[model samples]
Target: MHVEPVRSGAQKKEFIYLPRQLYRNSPWVPPLWMEEQNGYGRGKNAVLSDNEYELFIARRAGKAVGRILVYIDRAWNDHFQSSDGLFGALDAEDSEDTFNALIQAARLWLEKRGMNRIVGRFTRWRSSGGF
Candidate 1:
């Protein structure tokens, strides 16, 4: 699958819909957590603003498969005094190619914004993984 910026209103909806395909068979996960995924997928989080954050969705043959977000919170930078470009909201089927494309997209976005560093996992601390 390839990753690209979410293109239209319908595509945005498709971005919000990707988790359904990924998590439909998942068990032992609570309903509210699922709701948070839907909410953030649509960029409804309070910290989101048009000038700072943008989201992208991944698709294959016109079907949604994965997603990543590109964000630079002014307040976050102001407080931390850092130039790190934060990216998260990554969810996929554990495919290396799919994950790489998503990472490349976010990297390009951050590079365009003049950010050399990346901090993620959507938490106060970074998570260690293949990324």
Candidate 2:
């Protein structure tokens, strides 16, 4: 599996649809498609407009299999005096390799930003629930 940063609408769409596809027959109920799309948009996601963040999609054989979102909240860091990165909205196939690739991609991005610690759920979630 290989990981790539989500840089376009197409990538965002793929990232948004991953969980729905992966959990089609499971009990997970995904948030509305538009809501998922808006959550990734700078115009709609105000937190993103003010924070440093990136979304990564993991793929195997050219198909999206996982995704992870990593962000550094400068305001939160300044208030706490902590060099930490927050990762969330994680979703992946059952494969260990897919999970590893998603995590490594997030780690590399955080490391590049000088983050010393990562804190938060790496589970799949739109709000407080997970897949």
Candidate 3:
């Protein structure tokens, strides 16, 4: 498995679409396509409009299988007096290896930023909160 930053339109599309494929047969209700795209678009996500964040795509056998967004909310940190990194928009295949790889990537990304703790499992979309 490989984890890479979302750096291109194609990768971004994959990041947005992976969950749909993963949850298609479940009770999940996907958000509108455009809404998902805009949440990651510059100037589209209100809460994260001025926040620090990064999106990552995970692949296995050359196919996208998971996605994650790691972010730091300064206000939350200030209020809680902790530098905790948070992740959202996380989705993955039913493989433990894939899930571990995605989480390890997010942890490394956050650790580099000086965050000592991590909390997450939120969705990037306004409505859906889990995956």
Pick the lDDT winner.
3
lDDT of 2 by residue, 18-45 (tens): 8998888899977888788788857787
TM-score of 2: 0.88
| lDDT leaderboard ranking | 3, 2, 1
Worst 10 residues of 2 by lDDT: 122-131
Candidate 3 lDDT, tens digit per residue, 1-131? 99999988988988999999999899999889998889886599865787788899988889988998988888889999999998888889899998899889999999999999989876336545654
Model 2's alpha-carbon lDDT is 0.87
The residue-by-residue lDDT of candidate 1 on 21-86, one tens digit each, is 788888725335555555553366666643376778877787677888778877878799988888
Query: Please, what is the TM-score per model?
Result: 0.77, 0.88, 0.88
Q: In model 1, which regions exceed 4 Å deviation?
A: 28-44, 123-131
Judged by whole-model lDDT over C-alpha atoms, candidate 3 comes out at 0.88
Give residue 127's lDDT in candidate 2 (0 to 100).
Answer: 64
**lDDT accuracy of residue 39 in candidate 2:** 86
For model 3, what is the error of residue 78's alpha carbon versus the real structure, in angstroms, after optimal superposition? Answer: 0.6
TM-score of 3: 0.88
